[model samples]
Target: MDSFSHAFIIAIPLLLAGNAVLVPFAVIGAVIPDIDGVFFLFPDDEPSRYIFTHGGITHSIAGASLLSLVAFIGLYLLSGISWFSRFFPEGVTMMAGLAILAGAMLHILIDYLAYPGIPLFWPFSTEKFTLGIFPGPSLMILILSLGLLTLILTGRAGVRHYKTYLILCLVIFFIYAGIALYANTETEGRAIPTMDPTRWITIVETDECFVVRPYDILYGRGEEISYRKYTNITPDELAGIARLPQVQRLCYHSYIVTAERRGDTVILRDPLREEKVFRYPLDHSSLVIPLQETRSGPLPKNTDRP
Candidate 1:
């Protein structure tokens, strides 16, 4: 979700409650999860380069909790100083921390529905929980939110107007997202009969890699394909690569959790990026990765699905 959508969506409730001091903190925390992107700006050769992969730890519940605690301490200390006291009300720091926590939690929950889902419960379980329903952001939602924001910030009436617009925005978002999620969920795992013979999901899996075939689903049968993971590498090879922190980080973001053998390279890709598999021109997300260079080997066979 865009920062504004989350900010207005989360902040309005606090505004309506007559605790507008928390609104700024709520908006601040909402965008904090994306700070992981900063790691990509600077260069690092070691595995630490992947230390803060976008949507890795910072998007997790634990990460959010830590940030909330940080916000609490920092703000509370600032409020203690006489210089900052004029701007901050008594107990505002504590309330701001709670607002931060609430906003961040909402951010994570919304992102969990997007493709190649977030590691919300990582360290405990690597399982990616995703609805893969909407595109994760709706322009409609943003527009409605901005309109309601105008109403909340400047209006003829006071609390009554703010409350109405706030409720309206929340209701509209829930209804819009709920419907899309429901539709996608209904279509997700099953292959529904169709007049078209278009392929839905096609993966060529072997003892090694799963080469996800490129196909469109909108024009044809709505079938879902699932696969199991296997690797041709021996225990020794697996152990060596597993030790590399970068490889572990790559695997962490990968939903497919499988590897392929490229030309003298060990390739691992998140199956969710299947559309990029056989593109004539490889894009970044498409040309996902080759874990580490190794012995060149025969490629996997083509296993077409019915």
Candidate 2:
């Protein structure tokens, strides 16, 4: 989810509950996990850079907890200052900290439920877990959230009606999710949601190739648009390529990668980049390494190479 959507979605309930003190803190916490986005500003040429990239440690459970704790300590210390103490009493710091922690957790949960999930157990585990039911930066949700925010700001919808508006928003959100879930049912492989709630993209992996296709909840599956064939490179060669720092980073970030041979080099890239259906802002560039024929004997029979 985008920062605004994260803040507004979390803030709405707090507003309804009338916890004004914790609202700002919680909003801060919700958007702070995205601090890792700064990594995107620089070139992603170095493997070490991926450690700080989006959906990395900052999006993990341990990282979020540490951030919340640091934030709590900061708030606690600030409350001791005379000027700050007048406005933010020391007694409320603990509660505010808890609210911030909850907000951060909520942010992780939202991302986990969306397509191309975060590394929730990062450092310990790099595997991403996602329900793939919601598209990140969902247009529908963003528009609805903005509309609700406008109503609140304009005084057209006050605190008394917050519950009504919130409930309505949730219903619409869930309805879209339900549609996505229905479309994803019995999917061949990973079902990735697109901006359109009714539309999805499926990536099915085979021993020989990776099949990419478009799917729609209302129209059923579409024709195959991409078929990325596995390279004829031997397993030993593949293992060596995987050991390279750059390739390791690429594999860590991309869920479905394809290998292709170009002359004396082998290129590895995420197959999703070939299609326009579901475009994630992740690093989709190819990692090319020189082809090194390390073995002297014939290639393994399981490999597609002759």
The digit string of per-residue lDDT tens for model 2 on 1-306 reads 778778877787898777877788898789889888887778876785565778778999999988888887887787778888776643446678888899999999888877667777777866667777677666766776677778878879776566765677688668867876677674677677777777777877677676777887777888985555566664455655554556656666565667777788888776564443435544544677786833233222211000
List TM-score per model, in order.
Answer: 0.66, 0.85
lDDT by residue (194-215, candidate 1, tens digit) is 1122323334445544444333
Give the deviation of candidate 1 from the true structure as CA RMSD: 7.1
For each candidate in the order shown, give its overall lDDT on alpha carbons: 0.56, 0.71
Clashes of 2: 0
Looking at model 1, residue 13 earns an lDDT score of: 78
Cα shift from native, residue 189, model 1 (Å) = 4.1
Q: Kindly report which residue pairs in candidate 2 clash with one another.
A: none
Candidate 2, residue 288: how far the Cα is off, in Å: 0.6
